[model samples]
Target chain A: MTWVTFLGNATDPKIGGIAFFGIFLSLVVFLIGQWLFKISNGFFLFQPLFVGMVLGIFILWLLSKWFGVALPTFYTAAYKPGGDILFWFLNPATIAFAVPLYRRNDVFKKFWLEIILSLVVGMVISLFAIYYISKGLGLNNDVISSMLPQAATTAIAMPISGAIGGTPAVTAMACILNAVLIYALADILIKVFRLNSDPVGAGLGLGTAGHTVGSAKAVQLGSVQGAMASIAVVVISIVVDVVVPPFAHMMGLF
Target chain B: MASNATQAKNQAPEHEPAPILQQMAIFASVLFVSSLISPLFPKSFPVPTPVIGLVLMYLLLATHIIKLYQIEKMADFLISLIAFLFVPSGVQMAASLNVFTEHGPMDGVMMIVTIILATIILLVVIAYTTACFMWVSRKLFHKSTDVE
Candidate 1:
């Protein structure tokens, strides 16, 4: 038993072959996504991350079938190595959010109580609404769990989702979905709600529901709304971090 | 108020972004130190290491122990790549493709409906609630001089 077997069966050349190929495959697919996103002029539908994931999975499936291997076996062998490494960076990325929160500390200082109070109320109400709606619709517990933390940006939301026994992948999709919905609806929502007079409230709402994408839309509305949205993204993430785990525990979701 | 914010931003001391290698080193050290500190907390209420790192980073910035210039570029870089970083986990969804089809298309449709409906309700509720609170706060805290 050589040291190589400790990692996996060393005698099998395919193991080493796939490892290098896996990293290359992930990078190439991601680069392709970036390219497509660029050419598409940053269209929401061509978002690089979303496009990369779908394309990567599709290509991996094709490779698995071509190689006469099981999908799980191929994935663990070929994609998981690079994929896992990429996923590990999510931790540091989560910490990077502190920068924006710090930069916009002024807005927070002025309306700290109002911002915190409103977000908490919104979060609590949203949680109850999501849980009961999912339950009433007879969605599975895993699906419900994923949907619970969709309000926060993906960096923060994914960890909380996993902690509370949700599927992080599903949570990721939900976060993106939430943002896209907000992007599409912001115009009509503003007009119907007559939010023209209150940019701060509008911004907070955008960031709370949409995360980054919503913030982008908020930016288009006005500078004040943009700043508010940015502030809301960080603050809501913090609120979700402190509040969701306990809430989930009490609800017996974990 | 918007002009006030721009004025505040202008008042901030201008600093060039840190050199790239130094930026990476600073980030790496923070991540390392944070991983070490996160375990000190009791297991009963688990806070993820990254969350702890966020607070630590905030304190460092607030105290000026670590200048914003040093990490701002790197931090922005990381935030931009969040989608790319999650590709691995998102791809894992491939493993569970059966989820959508296990109960047949009807169940899958129901699941989609549930997610969409819940998201819409949350969006509307949060927006109106936040706006309402802001309005009330302003009214309470800043009364008209006419009252006098």
Candidate 2:
């Protein structure tokens, strides 16, 4: 009915090239969200990624509700392929994290024991807490399994979730939500606990609970803290991957 | 003149700016190789392609097979844009709206609150425990240098 075909034609890929357009639009929306975040003086609630997600969702909703376009049509035409390509970058991006770890090799060597101990303890606490909380909440086993690996990065969490009979999408959501929570509240927790004095412990705690976004916060604290956070993300992720499956299986969780 | 010559000999070569194209190529090649190997393992395997890619890249850097300068720019660029890569996944949360609706908004709020509280408690406990360990180890080892 309308001439705004550039948005996408659900049936015709060649007419609109909506996959590429969707990515371009998502980036534009994200940049605007970033600008809003900056103007808000770095409010965590205004985090660009979260804002972008809300905006993207709203756009899809609008197309369906107001324009009379079906949801499935819009999804296949735009979101799926665009989202898949962007998601693919997550793999290489994870590998790139090693650069920071390599750059701070000295810190790793200097505080190896302390760092490893903190991560292991933190991870155990996280898994236990999730288990008890989910049980208390009366969540099903599948939901509990998905929520178990929320502390790890998405790249690592998804596989562990799958292996343990969890939903990958739910796991991804949990991981992102956890990161946002940590990013928003790291300072409050640090101040309340008097954690400012020990940067290595602080970084490890943040990364173990919060993952990459938490590491971003750690970077602001100092280089050693950032490096420690980077190491925690990788080490804790690997440890969780190895430990969660058999542990869950043994516990009859899977 | 002899001292000056010796100094010159000891100085390392000044690293030229790495070509962006080459750096990108190297980064892409490494990821490509990783993706190729990722599927060789069964789907049941918990280890993912990214972990393998990360290890491969780290080994290359540590072994001097790939200089930091060669991949530094591309790596940093990718890392800085890392948050962007998560946008689509975050947007996918839209699909879970049904879950929230089915459980009721109160339950959803309670779940989130519980998660946040648990995470904060976990963070504090871990930090304090680590500090205690460090202090105890320093005292036990009688190596003040070990604490820092």
Candidate 3:
């Protein structure tokens, strides 16, 4: 079929036209984001994924306007087909985390005690900190519940948030916000905190606070840092799995 | 001889990536098994399905059931796109923007500040504590465990 014919059929929910258009737009938007990132020399605001999502949403809104449909309906009919398919891969992508974790098992083996202990301690401290901080700021229980699991990566955090009566969408936004802030401010934080003395600690901090994006930055730092960051992601997720539920129950969040 | 095998394993990914078809088959099989296994976990603590898959993959690699070269390229490719895969969820934020603005702007600002402050605290605590512990342990037992 001609490209015009295919695109013209986008309004019909049953046809693959809108699905293909959604995928095409996502990729093109991603490429545009990458180009901006490259030109801006790695500015955090130009983060390709963030830029792509924002731009993609804006375009989807425009498409809805052009088609004279509500945003939600248009997104459900047109964009969600391809978007859901891309989201499905997040599961396998998460599993792919094992590659680096396996390669870096040596670090875990040697420093298991230190790594686990420090993370557990930090986890407890952060849990209390998040709880009190939110309460102090007069935020409601739902927001507090969402923030509680923010230390974990997005995949793991969302389920825990939902179980504990929190909004998974907000949980995701908090996760990405934490990641972007860490990615942008890591260098300065390291300098201020004197984290240069321990790459492993720095890496773990990045992964625990920032998730995969932080790990991406960790990879840029060095192999050891990359490995540690990967391990930290796994450990922190496991910790959140074990810890957040009980903590939430005790706090009456659930 | 043992060291030589280790060296070869380490160098494998640098040689060439696995073919696309092979990578797809591996990922498909892994996901299938993980889907079957994830439902077995208890309800109170719902460990994510992908995490179960992660553990499964780690075990396979650790026991040499799957070598690094077999899935290295595919893993890297997927991991790199992690940020991209998250975009849809991020875009969903557009729908929830009212959550922030429902209250006055000051309430929203406070919530943002709370999240940022809590994060900064988490970062500092984890980094410093981990570093201090590692340093202490190394000083006590200098058995060449230093990552540097």
Candidate 4:
């Protein structure tokens, strides 16, 4: 009814009652989001984070069309200042994945030969599939760039999208899409291809592209895959770091 | 590698340095602090700071500046929470969809297409690199075995 409700208000409210209200509202939203995330994810489909983004987008799209309203934000991350504060919160959580990263190091060290070869094989397969699909569907550079880092963890992918001028907002969407698509389809693909369910096999597939969400899926598969996925998160991050900037600069898009 | 991983990281490796929980706490704190601090840095590039934080974490681990035990708890928690973290972002999709409806569809299709194309190109590189590494490794392995 009000402008606040219609256009979405992000005016800086005073830090007291608004603070309590913000926290309470955030908590409530958190719970509901958690519930939706879990319901789709309860069956252990891809990561709930991925599903949440898609579902959120779909919900927002429907709401606006039906009611002529927009969702609310605390900060102007939607338009200015920076990315959504929620993204900032998610960014910190990325660090929480140090265990997998550490284990990945151990796995790579131990099975250096096997890990390398298997990773290469997995990497090739995932990339080809993505490239062909995107092209066949006729997507543009920005969307594809965002999708390119899909398999990498979010912490790394977000910037990868940002680096080459891929929209973080859209990159955020791609991150979710990649996580969901891979998380949902990985096991099937593995089974379909008759790929070994070994740690190296599973981890390479998930971590190399699925990012952290994929690693979580790998954990459900087995510890070895889980460990490798963690390290892959880091390794892939490193890979992106080296690969993105030079490529972007060379392309002269910058 | 096995010996280093299982033995070096074992909690009771004959000379326990700290409680496991303490180790985990320290590790988690490092991750959290690093993650928070990363976004604070200058963003000269289009990429966000969290990516920088990831690289920094990797370097710290690789260089032995921050050992695994210290960060295990944090790592585990973050991985576990990965799915739930996207909720707020999901909510944004709702609004973006509406904006398009108001402005009309395909308003940002070009932006979308460019992003999608970039992803394809990046993946092509990743796949190609992976294949190349495999080929080189195999070549080196064969050469080493012949010499041996």
Local accuracy of candidate 4 as per-residue lDDT tens digits, B31-140: 56665766675554323445555556666766667666555555666666665555554454543443224324563564345334433333333434444454565587
TM-score of chain B of 1: 0.73
Native-referenced DockQ of model 4: 0.27
Ranking by DockQ: 3, 1, 2, 4
Give lDDT tens digits, candidate 2, residues A1-254: 25235564444655744567568767987898899899999876777876787788887777656657665455555576677778777776777766766666666666778777767776676677778887788776877787777766777788788878877776777777777677667877788788978877887887677777676677677766777777777787777876678767875887
What lDDT score goes with residue A118 in model 3? 89
- What is the per-residue lDDT of model 2 for residues B32-142, given as tens digits with 9 covering 90 to 100? 898888778765544567767777887786666877777777777877886677777666665565554456776666556666765776577667767876787689976
Q: Give model 2's DockQ, 2 decimals.
A: 0.39
Off by over 4 Å in 4: A1-11, A15-68, A72-89, A111-133, A140-168, A244-254, B12-70, B98-148
User: lDDT tens digits, residues A121-180, model 4?
Assistant: 545454455555655666556555555555555555677677776655565666555555
Q: Model 3: which residue pairs collide?
A: none
Best by TM-score: 3
Poorest lDDT segment (10 consecutive residues) of candidate 3 chain B: B1-10
User: After TM-score superposition, what is the CA distance of residue A72 in candidate 3 from its true location, in Å?
Assistant: 3.3
What digit string (tens of lDDT, one per residue) describes model 1 on residues A112-174?
A: 677778888888888988888888888777778877888876766787888899887778767
Q: What does DockQ give for each predicted structure?
A: 0.42, 0.39, 0.55, 0.27
Between candidates 1 and 3, name the one with more favorable TM-score.
3
Model 1's number of clashes is 0
lDDT, candidate 3, A3-104, per-residue tens:
333443454555534567666777888889899999998776777776887798898788778867776666666666667778788787777877766666
Give stretches of model 2 more than 4 Å off.
A1-13, A69-73, A162-165, A249-254, B1-13, B40-44, B103-106, B118-122, B143-148
Predicted candidate 3 versus true structure: per-residue lDDT over B25-127, tens digit per residue: 8878888898898788776566666767777888887777877788888988887887777666666655566567766788678777977886687778888
For candidate 3, the docking band is medium
